[model samples]
Target: MVLHAVPPTVPRLLTDRSTSEPDREALVVDGVGALTFGSWQRRATGLAERLRQRRVAPGDRVGLRFGAAEWLDFAVAYVAVQRLGAVAVPVSGDAAPAEVAHALADCAATGLVHGGGAPGWTGGWTHATADGDDDTGDGADLSTSDGLAQILYTSGTTARPKGVAATHANVTYGAGARHRPFRHSRHLLHAFSIGTNAAQVMLMTALLAHPAVVTLPQFTPLRFARAITRWSAGTVFVVPAMAMELLAVADGHDLSSVRLLGSAAAPLPGPVAARLAAAFPNATIVNYYTSTEAAPAQTAMTYDPERPDSVGRPIAGGGLRVTDEDGRPCAPGEIGAVWMRSPAPPRTYVGDTTTSGATFQDGWVRMGDVGYVDDDGFLFLVERDGDLVKTGAHRVSTLQVEAAIHEHPEVADAAVVGLPHEVLGVELAAVIVVSGGAALTPPALRAFLAGRLAPHEIPSLVHVVDKLPRNRGGKVDKRSLRRSLT
Candidate 1:
């Protein structure tokens, strides 16, 4: 298979990097082995040839299910699917069977490529692998910047996951936007699971960023921290949950090698950010906000003491605004719907007209969030639109309550949801996971929040759990929480 010179599409990006820096390390799976650009190109091409033999063609949807430990194979499979101009649909390896089945059936997938001994579906879907037949054969070039490239499902913390489809133009919008995203980093470290938007961003970073991407087979506080020291990683990224865990075990690790620490996939509380600042004394902590439907368009804020609550302004070339019910822009400091825009074409929901109509508009994507902007143009998110708790007379932000809960010394993880209340219409409820050797009760937690929160804002009922239920994106599964609570 030969790739000709083309525009800056996903396939073209891979070809450019491999040809220019074939001997450089492209990917490093800490516990597993590393793969250089040369090896990655050859393996991906061979896999693409094999997939072509299996009758896969352009515009076909191919499912990629590989365990976390199989990052190398997953990378090859993803690039191979792109090389063949097929739409890649990746699901978390640990996703439930039913979830996997839904994605395959919903997309009417043409074939599947799974590794690490993943179970095969019962349906008559053709199966292939990255390590499978490697026959070198000539193939037609069917790739284009406008062609659909991949489909990513939302985390579905509050409802069923929606498939967000993106084209090659959307995926490779910023391929050459900068000389290098992380100037000081030689190795970018993260342990995000496969099939997530975060994981996709990291994959692109491996191909485009200055650093060689490094990841662990699994994510544990100790293991992740140790990888930083062992690899001398200059940049690191994690979600809020992982950041909290890292702080717990940060005492023994020499994390000074890190210059930038980024948190994404969920909100980062003010208190948590303060603690992270002290824990990684030398690192500049930052928070990133974006959704599965919105990529290459995001807001990033390097921690500022003055605007601790802000999620930061839009990066260069991106646009952000808060609008009211009529889709009119709201003034600064006014709470409204959040919308973001990028130069690339926006992604849309697959086969869901109602949702697609509401989400993707003229050139902006509705964030499905409620937030405001400061006079200085920094964005501050109040809550996910669906997470707002509307009681009898007051509207509450779950993010505000959760942020307060995280301030409690005994709290390890917390989630707030509105429960059915016959008289009040809806009542505030909180589910909390206490730190090890710590004991907390409903009354005790409420007492801690007395001065910090208003009466209506405080949770009416609280439950202690060994762990808060979370989806693959490290976000609390509030839909599941409501099911068990009621």
Candidate 2:
């Protein structure tokens, strides 16, 4: 197989990398072995040609359905779709038929490529299938900078998921861009699903910098910990929940090779952050704050002793503001809605003008999160705008309550939500996961938090659960929690 440099699009990044270093390891899986740069380019391009042979043309939406550990199929289809100039929509392989149907209808996808999700595919779109293979040849380079490259669906909690349309430039920011090389970079380990922004960042990093991208196709506490030791992965990215899980079992595994640990997709609880810092003492531990819609509009920080809760300031080229309900700026330390402007050029929702009108205004996207910046210019998220609870005459933040609960040594994990009340408009309710061999009572737990939180923020009712339900993206599925209670 021969390789050559192409354009700056993602497909070209792979093809170009293959040319520059054909024998270098590109994608690594435990049981599936590895794919060299040359082999990956050859296989991905041949699949792109097959996609073109079908009526799957440029500007079409292609749904890619695959399970968690099937990165090889997922990565190939991603390159294949983009190489053919079609917008790829990655659907969770575990989605129910109703859920899959909704996504298929929402994007009006032209093709459904069932790589490894369900037994066979069912969709109105034409179908393309992928197992795995390698045949050398190049496909047509039809991608443009401004063309719609992907339509990533958000994990819908309250309503149907909305599609976020990303342009080629929006997704391929660092591909072939100039950056100083790292001193001792090794493989990058991440267990992120293919659809998330963090996963895309890892993909770009793999193409641009990392010699190989190591992943846990399936994420369990032990498996995640052992992968680090097995691969000697230098960098790892995880959501706060995954980070928590790793904290629980990481002691058994050797993680000395890690030099950079990144957390995002949710707030890293202060206690959890401290534990992770100690666990990876030599690593530069950082947490990022970003949204699906207002992506690349992120703030990051290397963990600080004094400002542990702050999610850092606006990164270079990014914009941020905490504004009152009337659109005026909030004073430092005053809580307000967070609005962000991405470093990438403006983006709007696909086929949802009502939401587009409400969110995308003057190039700024309303983040729908409530937060405040501290005196030292560090941003702190209080809660989601809709997640705030109104109890009697006062409002409360669930995150504040949950943070306090996590401070208790007996509490492993906790989630707070507003429950319907007869007297008060809404009452605070706590769902907790206690540590192993530890027992917690409602009265004792309430007393534990009484000193840490305001009286109004304390839970009126407590329920002990073995685990909190998590969505595909690892966020607490409050909607499911509500359903389970009712």
What TM-scores do the predictions have?
0.95, 0.95
Tell me, by TM-score, which candidate is best.
1
Q: After superposition, how far is residue 455 of candidate 1 from its true place, in Å?
A: 2.2
Clash pairs of candidate 2?
none
lDDT value for model 2: 0.79
Each candidate: RMSD = 2.4, 2.6
Clashes of 1: 0
Off by over 4 Å in 2: 1-7, 125-132, 180-183
| C-alpha lDDT of residue 188 in model 2 | 77
The sequence of per-residue lDDT tens digits that candidate 2 reaches over residues 16-80 is 78897899987776666677878778877887888888877889998888776777777878888
Reference-based TM-score, model 1: 0.95
Least well predicted 10-residue stretch by lDDT in candidate 2: 1-10
